[model samples]
Target: MSVTSTLGNALSGLTAASKAASVVSSNIANATTEGYGVRQVQTTSVSLNGQGSGVQVVSVSRNVNEGVLADRRAADAAYAQAATLASFYGSVEGAIGLPGDEGSLSSEFSQFEAALVEAGSRPDSDARLANVVRAAESLAGTLNDLSADIQSERLEAEKEIARQVDNLNTSLAQIQDLNGDIRLQIAAGNDPLGLMDQRQVLIDQIATIVPVSVVDRDFGQVALITESGGVLLDGTAAEISFRDVGLITPDMTVASGGLYQVEINGSPVDSTSPNNPLKGGSLDALFEIRDELAVSAQGDVDAVARDLIERFQNSAIDPTLSAGEPGLFTDAGALVDPANEVGLAGRIELNARVDPAKGGEVWRVRTGLGATSPGDPGAGGIILALSDALSEPKVVASGSFSSIPRTAAALASDLLSTIGAARQASENEVSYTAAKWETLRSLELEGGVDTDAELQKLLMIETAYAANARVIQTVDEMLDLLLRI
Candidate 1:
């Protein structure tokens, strides 16, 4: 080959080697970077008259397994959903308290029952009556606190949903911007791998908030769609919106037309409905907790309160109570109507007529609320009847409990067990989904940059660079010899 042609081939080889080395160095540098895809320089062979000339750098392309990436994103979303559910359940369990804890509703109910038995044994003792009243108050306060906590959590979840919606919009906009930049860069024959990596990172971030599917477009552009087949972005991002309801209460429910709804691109989406587009992500889980799980828990507490109110309201249990009049237990010092069963737990209170601290007489325990005169001070009849009323098996109206007759204490225990079971189930799901997500993430990393492979490639690039330099040196020496001749 002519020295000129030889020099040209050597220079082309040198340029290709330099570009390959750059790609290898970049791969090593970003080995640990999150969402970074490994890159390789594409090369094409040059030919002259059907003979090999040299090699030319075509383009730099990122190495990414789209299928694995898609699976990882899906796993991320599922894990986020499970984690959200588990977190909410844990909060509820904390608020409900464990069976043996002092503040637990079950424990307080047991204390009240014990106090009633003691008072029943010594009906004449004002101290025992006072203790019974205190225990009843404690039980009522515990239920009230739990109900409030459930509602508070619902409100917080609503607010969090609003915040997440805003974050989702921002992420979508950023991704769209990057998509435009990448298309422009590709059209200009420039490397767009860096922009593509940044875009992938944004996509992963948004996946945790809501499950999404990615579609590849021409010129390095991508479109995003939700798992439910709702288009989130194509050429531009769609608007996501949510209505925030401040200071939620038990009465505020979707069925009652009190709660706010989620909107996507100006279309109302029922967050609680099965067809929700935002399913399988943290946002969906939060909505479920706020509108469904928390509401059901509050209903359970209200049912317990209704059971208590109804049990004591029976004149057979407390003859002093007139028909329709409240007995020892009242709803905020008033008779609880069966129609107003909601929020009963938050309103449950001890009858003031039997509570001396509330300006009533302790002797009222022995006498009926309707009795103008105090009955026999030593009359253990009413105390025994009250104790029996609490311990006797009775059918509860609350659907949360079995319709079969059970004592008040047994029903409370069952309710606690139910809550505990739900929390346990959620925790188990969290563990399972978290493991799955971690495994997928590990697989994705394994499919990413391999430092050892990159090092080997770097050595190859160095050898090629040295050989090309040798060819150039030989060509230069040959040219010098020709000049000397």
Candidate 2:
């Protein structure tokens, strides 16, 4: 070989070795960085007339397991969905209090029942009658507070959905911009690895909000489509929008103008529908909480209030209460109209006639709302009858509970049990999905950067660099010898 050819070969080897070392250094530097893909220096041999000419650095290719990455993204979406649901249910459980807690609905009902029994035994004691009124008020207040808490949760979920929509839009726009940059880099034969990595990070962020499927396009460009078949981005980023309500009430619902549906590019869509493209992520879970789970909880509480009103409105329960007259438990101090059962829990209150604190006579507890004057102070008949009305098993008109007959206290326990069961189910789901997500994430990290391998590669690069430097030195000595000749 000619000396010039040898010099050229040595120079090409040095350049390739330096590029390879730079790639190794980059890999080691970003070993712990999230969303960083490992890069390798791609090299090819050059030849002239069947003889080795030199080496060429072709491209800096990113090492990634596409299938494993897709699996991890899917797991992230599922985990977010489960976790959001569990959190909302946990909040509801906290608001309702534990089954036997003093401030809980079940506990309040038990206290009321116990007070009624005590009042029945001491019918002449005005203080005991006063305790009965207090217990009744506590029970109503517990239900009202719980109803308000549920509505508050709905409002929070609505606000979160709006925030998520904004985040999703931003991510989609950034991804689209990255797509343009990456495509340009690829077409210009420039290393687009950095842009591609940034795009992957944005895609992962989008996955946490909504499940998506990625499709590769020409020139390193990618198209994003939701698992639910909604196109998020093709040539341009799709717009996501939501109309957040200022306040949420128990009577307001998605179908009843209490909430708003998500929109895609000016088209409205139901986030909870089975066909929703945004399913399997935190955004979808929030929508289900605001529009479905929370709404159902409100309905159940309203049913309980309706049952209480209907039970006391019975002529057999309180003979002195004329038809249509407010009973001991009334809807905000008015007779309950069965037609309007919604928001009943928030409006439930003790009849003013039996609530001394509400400017009514306490003797009305025994004499009844329609009674003109107080009945015999010593008469235990009316007090005993009231106790019987609360203790006796009766069929509830509300469809929220089972059709079987149950005492008022038993029904309250059932309501608590229902809430507990729902929360437990959500907790189980969260545990399972979280484990799956972590496992997938660990696998992805394992497939990312191997520091040991990178070190080994660096050692090889050092050897090549040393050999190339030695060749260049030998060539320089040969040139010096020729000059002396």
Candidate 3:
């Protein structure tokens, strides 16, 4: 080979080796960086007049297993959904109070029952009557607090949905901008590796909010579509919209137009629908809490409140009650309108006629709710009657609780049991999804930049650099000898 040809070849070799070393070092540095892909330097032999001349550095490319990454993103979304559901169920269970827990529904009922017995034995004792009244208030307070808590969770879920919607819109817009940048870079023959890495990070974030599938586009751009075939982004980002109701009540629901559902590209879609495009992510889970889980819990509590109200209102148990009068438990100070009993739990309170705190006499517990004056001192029929009514098995109303006849105490216990079972099931799902996410993540990492492999490539690059240097040195020595001769 001519000296000039040898010199050109060695120079190209050195340049290629330097590029390779740079790529290898980058891989090592970003091994643990989230969303960073392994890089490789592409090269090809240069030919002039059909003769091999030298080498040329073509381009740098990133290496990532798209299939594994997609699967990992899916698992991550599933884990997020399961964790959200588990949190809702756990919160409800805590509010309802587990069995044997103080201030729990069952405990409150037990205390009320015991107080009723004590008051009945000493109906003339003002202290005993007052104790009975306080016990009833405690029971009512428990239900009131529980109902309020459920509504609070629902409101929080609504707020979270709004936040996620805003976040999703912002991310989609950013991705669109990145797509334009990537397309321009690719067209200009630039690397665009860093922009691609940033895009991948944004895509992964979108996946956690709503599981999506990426579609490759012209000029290295991408389009995001949800698993249910909703196009979140193509050339432009689809605007996601939601209205936070601010304050959710037990009676407010999507069906009643009280809660606003999610909208996509200006088209309203029910977020709680089974066929929602953005299912299997935290967004969907939030809707489940706002529209389904909390509503059902409130219904259960309302049913218990209805049971309490009707039992005391029954003329068979309390003849003092008129045909339309409230019993020991009133719904917001009036007779419970069975037709409008959605938030009865929050409204259920101790009958004001029997509570001095509400400007009623405690003696009313021993006397009658409608009595004009104090009844006979030995008269404890009202207390015993209310007590017996609570313990008696009866069919409940208004809620999805079992249709079978059950006592008030049994109904409360069943509500707790149902919540506990659901919580357990959701936790099990969380465990499964979490394990799956970890496994898929590990598989993804296994395909990421391996330090050992990068180091080995570095050694090869060093060898190539040394060989190219030796070639140049040899050429220099040959020229020097020729000049000396």
How many clashes (backbone N, Cα, C below 3 Å) per candidate?
A: 0, 0, 0
Candidate 3 weakest ten by summed lDDT = 266-275
lDDT of each: 0.87, 0.87, 0.90
Tens-place lDDT per residue, model 3, 259-282, is: 888889888886756778988899
- Angstrom error of the Cα, residue 442, model 3: value is 0.4
| lDDT preference between candidates 2 and 3, better one | 3
Indicate the worst ten consecutive residues by lDDT in candidate 1. 366-375
Choose 1 or 3, whichever is better by lDDT. Answer: 3
Residues 56-148, candidate 2: write the lDDT tens digits: 998888988888888889988888888888888888888777777879887888888888888888777889899999999999998899899
Error of 2 at 446 (Å): 1.4
lDDT of 1 by residue, 266-307 (tens): 998888667788888998998899988988888888988888
TM-score of each: 0.97, 0.97, 0.98
Give the lDDT ranking, best first. 3, 1, 2
Error of 2 at 440 (Å): 1.0
lDDT measured at residue 262 in model 3 versus the true structure, 0 to 100: 88
The C-alpha local distance difference test score for the whole of candidate 1 amounts to 0.87
RMSD of each: 1.4, 1.3, 1.2
Could you tell me which residue pairs clash in candidate 3?
none
